[model samples]
Target: MYSTILCRTIECLTRDPSQNRKGDPGVTIYKIELLKLQETIPDLTRFLSDSECQRANRYHFIKDKNRFIICRALLKLLLAEYTALDISQISIEVDAHKKPYLPSHPSVYFNVSHSLDYAIIAIAENPVGVDLEYINKEFNYKEILPNVYHQKEMDEIEISKDKYLTFYKLWTRKEAVVKAIGKGIDNDLYKISVIDGSHTIPSSLVCNQKNLYVFSFMVNHNYIGALALTVPINNLDDILFQPLPR
Candidate 1:
């Protein structure tokens, strides 16, 4: 399934500001390395709202705290480009499902996900969800598989030579689908399957009498990522992969 999906690697450190003036008709994905933005922490903090700052302060560890700050700050920076609004003036609100949206710009829909080293944002004209997972080989997938993955998915992972990578691929896809629906992990993870070759779309779920599509990809050698969107896969073209400036 991944082999058929188009994935591009972006190396630019900056983007044209004019590109953000309007939302793309298709999906636009922005990738950022947290370490690259560490120097701008102070500036990023200033762009965050009071509520965001409070939430960042709640992190128990300094690293965790900074990760939150960098992710949020970058989100605002990218969003500012798309909305053509001042970074500080970008009003963000969470829905009942805890998915963040631009209240002033309802047509723009987006979702964000981060792994240990990278943060990714997916923007589209419709509802979208994205997930990124850092491949951890030492972690115990054996104990957690049954609870989150369907039996068929578990069978694929168990028989694989590299169970760790397989697990993350399936996990990110399921997460992307739930996040696309704005339900987060509250939905049953086992209900979706990415390994079932029959479902050409990465994963699928029926929501409000409509079907959602998920597509998985390899973000880098170390990270596995997935994107879920309301539009059918065939209708999605022009997925731009750009790197956000620090």
Candidate 2:
């Protein structure tokens, strides 16, 4: 699996930035016809699970059943060609930290993350964790930063010119690693240090942890992406990369 897959709203990329912020994030709907595409990849058909999916988490303060439909749909569409099965055949489970796994295909483990305009699904045969964060200056970093990082990390902020953004890069990377380990913020982040100085990525990023490869990407002109994967596997270059057909 990759450290993480960073994505953006194909629609959002075209909209006026101010409008996306002022109004509700536009709703996206999935067409049932795409489900029929499963004929091409029969394995994905199992992922539809219409009964429970029809009932999503209504308790959630915000509602987006359509988003879930499309997210799963997109995943099946992507995997269809590889397994040559339908999108609905794909089955997944979530771990204690909410990491998603493929039960039918135990060799494939993945993590899903999204931002206001983007949804990403990462797949790997190895157990992995993934997280994506869109830096919001309006968001409070101080309140949440301490839970994982210590005073030293906080102190680094004062001395850095882009301390706020640095916090996100570090924060996202830490969270990604935590998720990879199947642990959430409940795990201590003191063990992780993301130091990107003079092209120097820390040797300690995961020296203690064996077989995990960490990678990061910058997105939305400002947001940072962090991903961690178990190593000795395929490097990302071998994987096919493409955006979903919005």
lDDT of 2 by residue, 54-99 (tens): 5444435322554555567566665554456665676666756566
State each model's C-alpha RMSD to the native: 5.4, 10.3
Q: What is the TM-score of each candidate against the true structure?
A: 0.83, 0.65
The regions of model 1 sitting more than 4 angstroms off are: 1-25, 196-206, 233-240
What value of lDDT does candidate 1 attain over all alpha carbons? 0.73
Note the Cα lDDT for every prediction shown: 0.73, 0.53
lDDT of 2 at 143: 76
Worst 10 residues of 2 by lDDT: 23-32
Model 1 lDDT tens row, 11-68: 2223463364243347778877888778888988998889999999999998889899
